[model samples]
Target: MNKHNAEYYISKLGLLPHPEGGYYKRTFQSEEQTSDQELSVEFEGKRRLYTSIYFLLGSDDVSHFHRLKSDELWYYHAGSPLTVHVIDEHGVYKEYKLGIDLENGEVPQVLVPKNSIFGSSVKDEDTFSLVGCMVSPGFEFQDFELFTQDELLAKYPQHQDIIMKLAYDLIPV
Candidate 1:
């Protein structure tokens, strides 16, 4: 186990509380812009080629189910493995474990395709998982959509357990 706790990494990395959950710090934002023609009309204008952030999720916290217009790739960095749950466009539920334990079936990288609703959690108590997420065509607040438990249940009642665990009734500011 890592001797450093969640607080240690938060302080060391200068992470701030993320609206979704846990802590994060934007690490990179590409200066290059993507051609507006390459993206959907909802993009409005050209966006940075890509953006990256360091995301940390603690045992008791969950990254709420949210949708992004762009695809994201998660790379495990430290601590225990984390599980990323996703509901695809077709309403299929899937899970990806991110960690270095290849023998245990944990992958070093997990991809959340565009238009997928996804969230993540660390399963072990007193432990946290750190990862880096890279988003293509960058990430814009206008393209992010957060859902409430009730809202998601209406669309995906079959995922009641996960929705109840990850979706929030009220998001804290």
Candidate 2:
């Protein structure tokens, strides 16, 4: 078992609460913006070209199913393995394990495509995972959408098990 608990790391890293669940702190934001003229219609307005955050998930916490308009990259930092669950727009479900165990097929980083519903949790119940997330076209509140259980189930009935497992609202927060 890990020597440190979630509270220890939270205090050490000065992380704040994240809307999608878990604790996080914005680590970087680019000053450069994607000009309105150059941005796609999906984007509401101009946004910084990049942004990143230090994300942490305790054994009791789960990053809920949510979708962003911009692509996101996840980098594993420490602790137990994290399982990132993704359900693409076409209803395809996939899971990516983030950890240092390359021999066991765990990858240190993963890219979640834009508009794909995604969530994460520590694979080991006794441990926590610290990670960094980078978003391109920078993150904007207008580009984020939290999933409702009903909406997700209706769209992807085949992935019911995972949907129920990862949807934030379905579980105690």
Per-candidate local distance difference test? 0.91, 0.88
lDDT of 2 at 159: 90
Name model 1 segments beyond 4 Å from true.
1-3
lDDT of 1 by residue, 1-173 (tens): 33568888898889999889999999999998987788764687889989999999999899999999999999999898999999999889999999999999999999999999999999678899999999997988888888899999999999999999889887655
Report the alpha-carbon TM-score of model 1 versus the true structure: 0.94
lDDT of 2 by residue, 110-131 (tens): 9999989999989998779999
- Give lDDT for model 2: 0.88
Give each model a TM-score: 0.94, 0.93
Candidate 2 versus the native: TM-score?
0.93
